[model samples]
Target: MKPLLRVVLVIDALLLLAFGLLFLLTPWTSLYNALQLAQVEPALVGQGFGIALLGLAWLALHASIDGAMTRAVARTVGHVNWLTGVLMLVWLIALRSPSLSAFGQLVGAVVAVVLVLIGLGGVRLAAAVRRREKAQAAGAGATGREQKQAEKAEKQAAQAREAEVYQTEPVTKVSPPVSPATGRRVEPDFTAAHQPGVVTAETRTVETRSTQTHTAADEARDAAADSPGAPRPPFHG
Candidate 1:
C-alpha cells in the first residue's frame, strides 16, 4: 500500500510539473496554444500561478521519496486533486471557458478523470495502511494474552503439586517433653502412691544411709541393759 501510494505521488508530481512548465513558458512561447489552455491576462499572473504549481510538484515528489511524509501529503494532495478535477469539469462542460475546440475539451476531460482517480487512490491507500497497522496491534495483544495464560497455568500446576504433597504426607506422633538441663527424658507425674519420681543412683544412696542409723541405735540400748550399766526403777507399787 505504501509503495502504491508513493507511485501515486510520483504521478501527481509529473502532471503538476508539466502544467507548471507550460504556464511558465507562456510569456515567451505559443506553447499554451498547443494545449488550448486559456492564457491568463498579465503574463506575470500566469507566471505566479506557474510558480505555485511548481512548488506543489516539488512537494509531491519529495513526499514520494521520504517514506514518513507520504501518508499526510497523499491525503492532502488527494483531496485537493479531486476537487480541482471537479471544478475543471464544471468549467469545461458548464461554463465552456477558454472557447477551445472539441479535441481540447476532450483532453481536459481526460485529465480531470485522471486527477479524480489518482486522488481516490491516495485516499484508499492511506485507509489500507491504517487497517494494516490496526491488525498488527491486535495480533500483538493476542500474543500477550496467550503468554499470560501459559504463565498462569504453570503457577497453578505448582500450587496443585504443593497441595497434593500436603494431603498425602504421613502424620508425625507426639512425644513427651524432655528436660533441657539434665538431658533426661521426663515422664508425666501420676496420682498413685506407688508411682515413683525419676529414680536415679542418688535417691538409692540416701535411703540406705537412713536404714543403717536406725539399726545401730537398737543394738546400743540392748547391750547397756545386759551389762547393768543402765539406770533402773527403785520401787514399784
Candidate 2:
C-alpha cells in the first residue's frame, strides 16, 4: 500500500475508535439527545452500540487490506459500509421529527451521497491498481521471452558462423608418383637400345673366359707333344 493510503486507513481507524469510545463514554441522556430520541429506551442505546461496533468492524477490515482480496469484494464491502452509514444518518435525521423536516434530511442526504461517492471512488482506485499490476506482469513476461529468443538466435548465429568458417578453409593433398621400370624406384637405361650388342659388360666377361680356356688347351697340347703318350695339335686358320 502507498504511504498516503496507509495514512488514510490509519485516520479512518482512529475515527472509528473515537466514535466507539464516545458512544460508550456518553451518558444515556446525551445519547438520546444526539439521536433526538424522546423515549430514551434501552433499545435505542442498544442500536447505538450496534452502530459503533459496525464502525469498529469496518476499521478492522480496512486495516487488514492485502493483495489477495478481489477488487470486486472490496468495492462491494465499501459500498455496503457507505450505505449503512447513510442509513444511520437517516435514522438520526428521522428521529429529529421537525415540522418542516427538510433541512436535517437534506444534510443527511448530502453526507450519504458524499460517503457513497468516496466508496465508489475507492473501488475504481482498486480496479486501477489491479490493472496496472496485470500490465506490469505482462510486460515483464514479454521481456523475458524476448530475451530468451535473442540469446538463442545469438548462439545459433555463432554456430553458423563457425561452420561457415570451417567450410571455407583450404585443404591439402599429397601422393607418390609411379615408375614404369619394375614399377618401382629403378632408373631406366635408354642407351641399351641403341648399342644392342657392342661388347656389353656381360658379353665381354664371357669372351674373356673362353679365350683363357683356349690358351690353356694349347699349352697342354705342347706339353703332351714332348711326352711319351700325348695328343697332337691340329693346324687351323
Candidate 3:
C-alpha cells in the first residue's frame, strides 16, 4: 500500500476504535443526551453496534501492520465499509427521526462519506497489487527462458571445441623402413640424408655391392676366353 493510504487507514481505524470505546464505557443516559435521542433503548442498541465496529477497526489495524491490505483482506474491508456506509445512508433517509438534532445528522453524514471513501481505496489497492504480481511473474518466466538458451549455446560451443581439438592432434604410429641389402626392417636415418655433403650407411653399402659385381663380371669374361667353347673377337685395327 502507498504511504499516504496506509496513514489514512491507520487514522480511520484509530478514530473508529475511540468512538466504539466511548459508546461501550459511557452510560445509556450520557449517550442519549449527547445524540439528543428520545429513546434510551436505541442507546443500548448503539453499544452492541459499537462492539462490531471495534472488531472491524481491529481488522483494519492488523491488515495495515502486516502490510496485507490487498486481495482477501482488502476485499473484506471494502465490503464491510460499503455496507456500513449504505446502512447509515438508509437510516438517515428512511428513519429521519424527529428526535435527532441537526448536529447528530451532520456527524452521521460525515462518517458515511468517510466509510465510502475508505471502501473505494481498499478496492483500488487490491487491483494495483494484482497487476504488480502479474508483471513480476511474466518477467520471471522470460528470464528463465533466456537462461536455458544461454546454457544450451554454451554446451554446443564446448562440443565443437572438443571436435576441433581431436582433428588437430598429430598421428604417432608409423611403419619402420626396410633395408634393401638384408630385406629386414630397420630404423630410418632421416637426418643423414638431409645433411649436406654426408653419405648415409645404407648408400655406402649399396655402392660397395655395385663395385664387387663389376669385378666379378670381368673375371668371368677372362675365364670364358681361355675355355675351348669360347668364340674369338674380330680385330678392330
| lDDT, model 1, position 35 | 64
What's the TM-score of every candidate structure? 0.62, 0.49, 0.63
**Once model 1 is optimally superposed onto the true structure by TM-score, how far is the C-alpha of residue 30 displaced, in angstroms?**
2.2
Lowest-lDDT window of 10 residues in candidate 1?
191-200
Candidate 2 on 29-140: residue-level lDDT in tens? 6664555434324555855875765575465456447435434445554565477566756665665544224554565566566556555655565566678778999999
Please report, as a residue range, the 10-residue window in candidate 3 with the lowest summed lDDT.
Answer: 34-43
C-alpha lDDT of residue 164 in model 3: 98
Q: Pick the candidate with the highest lDDT.
A: 1
Better of 1 and 3 by lDDT: 1
lDDT to native, each model = 0.85, 0.60, 0.74
Q: Candidate 2, which ten residues in sequence have the lowest lDDT sum? A: 1-10
What's model 3's lDDT at 14? 82
Model 2 misplacement above 4 A? 1-8, 18-29, 32-77, 85-111, 171-237
Winner by TM-score: 3
- lDDT score for residue 186 of model 2: 37
Report the CA-based lDDT of candidate 3 relative to the real structure: 0.74
| RMSD after Cα superposition, model 2 | 17.0
> After superposition on all CA atoms, how large is the RMSD of candidate 1?
12.5
Q: Which whole-number lDDT from 0 to 100 does residue 196 have in model 1?
A: 66
Ranking by lDDT: 1, 3, 2
